[model samples]
Target: MGPAPTVHAESVDFVMLYIVAISVVLLIGITVTMIYFVFKYNRKKGHEPVDIHGNVLLEVVWIVIPTLLVLSMFYFGYTSFRELRDKPDNPFIVKVTARMWQFTFEYANGKKTDTLYVPLNAPVDLEMKSVDVNHCLYIPAFRIKEDIIYGQTNHLYFNAKQTGDYDIACAEYCGLNHSAMYTKVKVLLDNDFTKWYGGNWQPVKNGSASN
Candidate 1:
């Protein structure tokens, strides 16, 4: 079908759009203000540089406006980040281990694969650890990325809404073949995943065919 959907899709979109909107507004405002000041106080126009003390009202306006804007941005970003950090209850948990240049996923049923297989629309918790150096599991489609440490357990969650194969890669630079330290996350339909989980395992071809 189409691309696999992640639970963080909307949140990511919101955060990105919010940041972009603010950036665009600020960019335009600052650019226009600079241009206006350039022409309004041009040296060629015989205007001398005025070294007057700054007006308290202008200073307060600038400070308060930017402070409010920054606070609002922080609020939105923190809210979105909090949603990503809050783990779901009783999710389909998978333990992920990163070693050298390979990735492994182990399920509760003892089923393991180099590729992560998750059920569509179901919350999946990835409990991750690194065997050697530090690594980060980055799934761009799910907007889920977390650092994996040798002595610590790092986790992230996602819920795929569609069946498809998404790319997974290590965001951290481990060593040689760090670029090759990549894999796929195959999102399957609920029924298909159930069958596979129950040991009636079959390959999913073209993301639609289970054979």
Candidate 2:
């Protein structure tokens, strides 16, 4: 009922809502219809089954309705996907290198960190590449997940609206320590991020590396 933490989260939420709503409606409708049919046509009632051989109108209605529904779902899904795929025009870029079990983020100022740091209410673009095998960068709070392929460049953009730490995980299993491929994204206010990025502000430790 409320907006998600990130800007792109709203769009993802909308798509998910649409899908869940449609699924619930269909489930209820089918359940109710089955119950009613069972009771109405019970053998105890001495009722005879009526044949509905080829009702053209019914056939057309079912076919057309489902076709339209599938098309609509596909359209909305594709639209939301495109919104994530297209990179921001001028986003704060960070280079991410993913290896067997660790993530190395290189900021514009040449500062590297094991964890991610971003500014609130600002668009940040992550350019990711895998050093050896396949990996995935997943931010659950932001609803952004993209694969990091070896020798191929992949990227995704997100705008953090809240100032807090969010979990980041490698969605793909790369090696033996794939589960250890975890980190946190620290979001700070505009001024604090500026200070930290400029190497002036010291961030409080939250069990992960900040520098």
Candidate 3:
């Protein structure tokens, strides 16, 4: 887990851990039970075998327990997925367009930039699309990825509590230069974001920051 963001880190990671833990427990339990049954029910040299068809309680317990476990896992998985789609209050919407090896982020004021810049502690809603082939918007640090499909608009939701520059890359194989499609998302303090959001600000050069 590298530089985990708030919302996705909590919800997504919890669901993953929950499912994994349950799987590990089930694996051990089932293996042990199988071994024990194999030893106990082994055939004796010359004894007649008893015909034990089935036990209703044992069968019901097995079916009910697995069904309940599966349902619970599905419940948590659905809730975690819903958390990503839940729009926050007082959101800052950015329109993102992806093409063959490039990403463009447009703010509400028509200010466009290659790098995504947002205020710390503020919610950001991304409206994404692709101009050419399909692309994927991926932020590894935050563990967020969304598909950018041509002729169809996609969306990604973000809320960063900390301030820093996070790496952004195209995860989908779009074209020959797909490996070179990369950018950064800068989360600035509230005061700086306000000043830059309202002013006629210019984008800084690569390897440089306005802060």
Candidate 4:
């Protein structure tokens, strides 16, 4: 048997690192400030709390700093999302249909199925919509997730750089079987994918087939 695909695992790791770093810095800063204030103004330590409340300059500084920080975060997040969703010059277009407890993927050649398959190192544009209730097309490995709203189409794009099996789950609560609404994405090397699609080769259960 061939080896399972690696999917977009690296992207997930990068995103996780970014989140962790941001969280750690914020936590440490808050913790240090809290501890410093507690020790500096302790009653038993021959210190008294200064009750100089409502300093305009301090209030303005706190408000402006937090506002700027939040806006910066928002800008970065929006740019990241824009880059992820924008269609590349020539992407492999795929149609995705989300249902109550399953997802159906359709290739450009009119083939349709539950599983998602794509060529590695290629950009893929997912034109997705919901068939029944609202659902989300979530590929954690790619750091991409978009809602598949009923009666409306949503799109997402990603370049799969690795070959592996990746999980696809609904990020929104659609129905009873929301937990079971999942699928797998298989990223195949370019040449191997061509051979597989052309009937010249088949993917083995546990082997690496390079492009």
lDDT of 2: 0.85
Backbone Cα, N, C clashes tallied per candidate: 0, 0, 0, 14
lDDT of 2 by residue, 1-211 (tens): 3457785788888888998899899899999999998998999999877887788998999899989988888998889888776654566788999999999999978999999998877678899999899999999988989999999999978878888889999999897999989999999897888788986332222222334
Ranking by lDDT: 2, 3, 1, 4
TM-score of every model? 0.88, 0.87, 0.78, 0.78
* Candidate 3 segments exceeding 4 Å error: 34-53, 195-211
Rank list by TM-score = 1, 2, 3, 4
Instruction: In candidate 1, list every pair of residues with a backbone clash.
Output: none
Per-residue lDDT tens digits for candidate 1, residues 1-211, read 2333765777877788888998999999999999999999999999878898879999999899989988988998888788776655466789999998999999887988999998877677899988899999998887779999889998888878778999999999999999999999999887888887886433232343433
What is the C-alpha RMSD, rounded to one decimal, of candidate 4? 6.2
* Cα misplacement distance, residue 52 of candidate 1 (Å): 2.5
**Candidate 3 lDDT, tens digit per residue, 1-211?**
5556557767777888998999999999999999987777777544567889999999999999999999999999988787777775546788999989899999978889999998876668889998899999998877789999999999888788778899899999998999999999999887798797896332332223333
Query: In model 2, what is the error at residue 12, expressed in angstroms?
Result: 0.9
RMSD per model, one decimal = 5.5, 6.1, 6.3, 6.2
TM-score of 2: 0.87
